[model samples]
Target: MSALLEADALHLRFGAVRALDDVAVSIWPGEVVAIVGESGSGKSTLLRVLSGQVAPDAGGVRYAGAEVHALGEAQRRRLMCTDWGYVHQNARDGLRMGVSAGGNIGERLMAAGTRHYGAIRDAAAEWMVKVELDPARMDDRPGMFSGGMQQRLQIARCLVTQPKLVFMDEPTGGLDVSVQARLLDLLRRLVGELGLAAFFLTHDIAAARLLAHRILVMRHGRVVEEGLADRVLDDPRHPYTQLLVSSVLAA
Candidate 1:
């Protein structure tokens, strides 16, 4: 099967700091790949570049078969609204806080040209249940929800359109430890049920272990290790990767 998303030899720099240096990645349909790294390690930058939110200074990104960076802004936006989904690390960035939860999900359906109000609402309610959110609270605004609830709402909004590929940046970050595990479980179930291709950035090795089939360990704008998630984490080859594992264990 062809890769659902592909990035090769990516190079991006901000002043003297290289955000990405000769990075390459690919995701197959129904497969999940996690990019794991510390802060400023370029995992998030790579995600943005792959999602077309930021254009790389060099190299190529293709989704399905189209050249991602070459597409017009409107085309890229349209692709995001329809075929691709992005879950922000912060729920606030991905959702309109003022809108009710149902409306948030409905908006994606609307973007896809769904005109029937009943159908949109029904789909929204169904997704709310799927994400472990109460459909009864669909009328509540994100600001009225807890942090975990807000994050789940953001996810519902993303998946409502049944995107083929989803890019998630630290989806389980910035949450209480207890909540993170539940959210990760929900994400794993959703990804499996939908058979979606996923690329996510995370510092939580446990999250990567639970969700990703493959893992990429990054440092200083380059991928230092790549392999099956278990192999990379169990017997990390690079000294940096080994340090990452040891640090997790020491915590």
Candidate 2:
């Protein structure tokens, strides 16, 4: 598989805090890669940078052999809006509370210059079904939905554009255990069926194991270990990775 996204020697700082330090990783087409670490380890920062939401102080981000920052604003917006989908850690950030479900999904199409209401409504309904959201609630506001339903709506909205690359920040975070399992299963199936490349950030070791084709374990803003999921999870080389795996197994 070709490299869909690449980050090299990434460095970022927020005054006295170093958010990322010389971080590097590459995501392949049609694969799911997870970046896992404890809080403040720069996992979320890396996702933000990769998705072009934040610029790094130094280093490079390349998508399909083209520099992300070097692209013009219009071009970046086009690519990120159509070819990429971003799911933030906070589900609320991923949704439009005031709009109906159909409106939320239609927003992506609107950004892509589609104006026909019929087309937008049909596309929205199709995608909502794809994400397992009921078409019956298409007119309901996000606030009217349950937490799990809101997350589902958010996923439906992001994916309506059929993005090639998706950046998911703790996608199953803040959900009940049952909801998390169901969502994880949905993600796994969608990635496999659509051949979508994903870069997901998470703290759940089992979530990583279940969904990621590869794992990048981070500590203190740097990736301490990276490898195939089974190898990394079953036989972690780094001390921190080992500890994480052991703790997950113990729990």
Best by TM-score: 1
Measured against the true structure, the TM-scores of the candidates, in listed sequence, are 0.98, 0.96
Cα lDDT tens digits for candidate 2, 103-155: 99999889977889999999999988888888998999999988887888888
Error of 2 at 166 (Å): 0.2
Cα lDDT over the full model 2 = 0.90
lDDT of 1 by residue, 1-251 (tens): 78888889999999999999999999999999999999999999999999998999999999878999999999999999999999999999999988999999999999988999999999999999999999999899999999999999999999999999999999988999989988999999999999999998999998999999999999999999999999999999999999999888644
Q: What TM-score quantifies how close candidate 1 is to the native fold?
A: 0.98
Between which residue pairs do clashes occur in model 2?
none
Task: Pick out the ten consecutive residues of candidate 1 with the lowest summed lDDT.
Answer: 242-251
Candidate 2 lowest-lDDT run of ten: 242-251
Give the true-structure RMSD of model 1.
Answer: 1.0
Best by lDDT: 1
lDDT by candidate, in order shown: 0.95, 0.90
